[model samples]
Target: MVVGATGTTGSRVVARLSAAGLRVKATSRHATPVDGARPVRFDWNDPSSFDNALEGTDRIYLVPPPGSPDPAAVMLPFLRQARAAGIRRAVLLSASAIPLGGPAIGQVHKALPDLVPQWAVLRPSWFMQNFSGNHVHARTIRADGTIRTATGEGRVGFVDAEDIAAVAVHALTDAQAPNTDLIITGPQAVSYGDIAAVLTEVTGHTVTHRRLTHESLRDRLAADLPIEFATMLADLDRAIAKGAEDRTTDTVQRLTGHPPRDFRAFAEREMRRPRSRPV
Candidate 1:
């Protein structure tokens, strides 16, 4: 089963798993059609949705809900239900910034392994798809060729969501459980300025990165998100500025047997694809 099946990485995981000839149950808040898989409605707040989604599924790809101040509060009950339903393995999507027992999803990261017979935690760096998804950065880039952040010049090895999905599929289907936390990242680190330059070269637009104070960034995010969540996001950006995410890892290559795609490759592929109307 793939929870949050319609999500950025979850959707890809579902597709890849199905393509590999595995029976997959993909779940979302609504019954959205997923090719080559059974679609089920599942919501974190609703326990009644759990049984149907967990039926006939032994492994699960977990995507935590967004804007969750405490993900464990929303995810733990469902995970317990999954265990009772006989689900044996789980692959959890976590962030590189949140270590085991740290904060947010880290709580789940610490408990998931012991809760299930087999499990793997994926701690991925900033996603390269942020520039193409419906995120604030993507919207700003599409609307005015500008990327706004409080990250200053902090470098990050932005991992591709596709690579994340591939590694997830491996973790979900491998005969022997990895039984460890995987720090997934791209081949090299790049700053927001470097991303802007890559965007300029790929999209033929004069893309630029605008640095903002953490306070200003928080205010901007609070316009669309809760104040507390906005403040937390801004603080993450501040951490980035302090070089918290400035490193690369071989986890993706080691697990998936291929080098992780770099930001430049991602930019070129995104440019070649038909552009979608900005959200």
Candidate 2:
């Protein structure tokens, strides 16, 4: 079973699992069909959907809800329910820089290792989907040709969402690597400047990364997003500026037995796809 199955990563995970002929159950709050798979109405805020989503499910793909004050509190019970339901293997999508117990969902990641009998936390770096998906910065860039963030000259080994989904399928259906954390990344580390260049080349427009003061960025973001959420994203940018997410890893290649895709390749593919009205 895959939670958040209509989301960027979850959608891809569902597609990949179904393509591989796995018995896939996808969860969404809305009634939408995933090709060749069952779409179950599931809401994280509502516990009533848990049993329906986990029924007869042996392996599960979990994506934690972002900005929750205590995601662990919400997920622990779900994990317990899955265990009780005889769901043996679980794969969780986590962030690369967020070490177990460090901050954010770190506590949730840390607790899962001891709680679940078989689990793997996928700590992937910044996703390449941020450029073309629902990310606000991507929308601004598509509309205004400028991407604003507090990350200054810092690099990230941005992994492609497809690569992450591919790895997730392997962890779910294949041999279970219990109680392990996979720090996944692309082939190389590149700065936001590099990302801008690739995007500009692919889109044939001047899309650049503009650095902003953390305070200024926070204030601007807080206008639309919750203040705490804005503060957390700004703080993450500060951490990026400090070189926390600057390193690259081979975990993606090691796990999937294939080289991770490049950022430029991702940009070119995204450009080829039909886009929505500007931004």
Candidate 3:
């Protein structure tokens, strides 16, 4: 089962699993159609939708409720139900900043090992898609040639979603489960300014990184998101500024036998894709 089947990493995982000829149940709120896989309706807030999605599935890919400050409140009940339904393995999509028992999805990460016989948690660094895909950074870049953030001179091993999914596939399909959290990252550590320069080069338009204060960024995001979630995101940027995400690892290369895609290559590839309007 692939939860959040329409999302960034989830969609890629579904495609990869289908291409590999694995039987997959793609779950979303609407039972949306996904090519080469079965579509099942599953809502995070609705426990009634859980049983049908769990039927006959031994492995599951979990995507936590996006933007929810307290995802454990909704996710834990379904996870317990999944355990009772005979699902043996689970792969959770988490973030680099969130460690086991830290906050939000971290609560799930801390509880996963005891809930399932086999499990792996992916703690990937910031995504490169934030600048090239349909994200706030991409939207801002396209609208006014600027990318805004609170990360001041802080560098991140920004990873590509494709690489993240590849590692996820390995975790899901390997006969032996990783049974640990993997810190996935790209090959290089770069700042937002560096990312802006790369976007300028790949998109044929000048782009600039605009740094803002933590308070300012929080206020900006709170306009559209919950206050607590906005505060957490802003705090993550503050943590980055302090060099929390400054390191890179060989997890991707070791597992996939291919070097993770660097930011420049990711930008160029996305620009070359059809209908890639934003860099």
Candidate 4:
């Protein structure tokens, strides 16, 4: 069972699991269908949806909702429900910055060991999907050839969502490892400038990373997000600027037996279409 099946990473997990001929149940808030899979309704706001989603499932792909203030409050109860429903194995989608007791998904990680027999927490770096998915800053970058962020010249090891899905499939299906945190990343660490260069090469336009103050970023995002969320994002940018996300890791290659895709390759693939200024 894959929670958040309609999401960027969850959809990939559902597809890969189904392609491998695994018995898969995919969950979506709406009735979005996954080919050759059964669709189940799952809303984080509703607790009753938890039991039905976990019924008779042995393995689950879990992704908590974004910006959830109390992830443990929501997830711990669901995990207990999953355990009671006989779900044993779980692959949790966590973030690179969140440690066992850290903020956000850390609450889930810290609680999982007591509830499930086997599990894997994927602590992956910034996703390449932020470029093509719903990330407003990345979309702005693609359109305007400029990415404005408070993160100034800090390098990040951005991993592809496909690679993350692949690793999740391995952990869910195979029986090699359990109860561990996997810090996955791209093969190389590069600055946002390097990312822009790659995009420029692929799109034939000069995309660049522009530094901004935290206050400016907060102001820019104030219209679309709550003040707290905007502040958190701006603070995260400050953390990134401090080289918090600079290091590269080998967990992807170690688990998948292939080197993780680089940012250049990801940019080349994503920028295949024409580019224009932001409308």
Candidate 3 lDDT, tens digit per residue, 1-279? 999999999999999999999999999999997867999999998888999999999999999999999998988888899999998999999999999999899999999999999999999999998986689998998899999999999999999999999999999999999999999999999999999888888788899999999999999999999999999999999999999999999999999999999998888888643455786
How do the predictions measure up, each by TM-score? 0.96, 0.94, 0.97, 0.93
Where does model 3 exceed 4 Å of error?
272-279
Better of 3 and 4 by lDDT: 3
lDDT, candidates in the order shown = 0.91, 0.85, 0.94, 0.84
154-185 in candidate 2: lDDT tens per residue?
88999999999988888887764646888889
lDDT of 4: 0.84
Model 2 TM-score is: 0.94
Error of 2 at 36 (Å): 1.6
* Stronger candidate by TM-score (1 vs 4): 1
What is the alpha-carbon RMSD of candidate 3 to the true structure? 2.8
Off by over 4 Å in 4: 274-279
Residue 234 alpha-carbon offset, candidate 1, angstroms:
0.9
Q: Which stretches of candidate 1 lie over 4 Å from their true place?
A: 272-279
| Collision count for each candidate, in order | 0, 0, 0, 0
Q: Quick one: ranking by lDDT, best first?
A: 3, 1, 2, 4
For model 3, which pairs clash?
A: none
Candidate 4 C-alpha lDDT tens digits along 59-166: 889999766756788888888888988988888999887889777688889888888999999999988878776687578875787888898988888999999998
